[model samples]
Target: MQRGMYESRAYATLLLKNILEVADPMHIMNLKPLVFTEVSDRISDKATKAALHILVNICPWGRNRHKTVEAGAISVMIELLMDEITHSKIDNVGSNLALLSLNLNAPYKIHSIHME
Candidate 1:
């Protein structure tokens, strides 16, 4: 999946979201890294948004919030927010970022997220 083109990855992420509706914890853990990677990829906003939506769904589960923080989702979401704000192109990303912020318990780490 990593070697696929951006469009393919975007489609795969959307498909994964559908699968995650009935997925187990093990499935969540296995998919988290790839989803987070796609969130930061920026090669396609479609892919990024799909990945962020997937994270929003899985983050509320047991231990997934901490794992998301460890995966650097906060920083990536913040970066995405900054870009969207600057460009005035905010979309579904705002709610995803908001959900992540509310779910994560790592306030101490927010200051460390790079803005530039």
Candidate 2:
């Protein structure tokens, strides 16, 4: 049987919880590459944004490590966020506010973002 797309918010929550509980730099380093492909497949812009935001927050960043997230995954997520912000209509104030917060608070530095 083919594996289904990740549908469990609970699973995501638990995974985040577990990762935070351990909080190991080496573990984060190991996991980054493994998660890249799966994360890239999540095409929905909102979902992608949410997932990447969570990943960035959970992974520890500093002068030495600079977050455990893989470069490939970060690149893909940045592209998706930029596309969504540029192409989507800001009809809902709440969503716009949330997106704005994410844009401001997200761990990665995004330069020249366009919101549509």
Best by lDDT: 1
Residues 1-45, model 2: lDDT tens digits: 016444564355445535644566555445544454454446444
As a whole number from 0 to 100, the lDDT of residue 77 in candidate 2 is 50
- What is candidate 2's local distance difference test score? 0.46
RMSD (Cα, Å) for all candidates, in order, is 6.7, 7.5
**Cα lDDT for residue 67, model 2?**
32
lDDT of each: 0.62, 0.46
Model 1: worst 10 consecutive residues (lDDT sum): 107-116
Looking at model 2, residue 13 earns an lDDT score of 42
Would you list the clashing residue pairs of candidate 2? Answer: none
Per-residue lDDT for 27-69 in model 1, tens only? 7655545556555555567666666666666766666666667
The reply for model 1, stretches above 4 Å from the true place, is 24-35, 38-40, 89-97, 105-116
TM-score of 1: 0.66
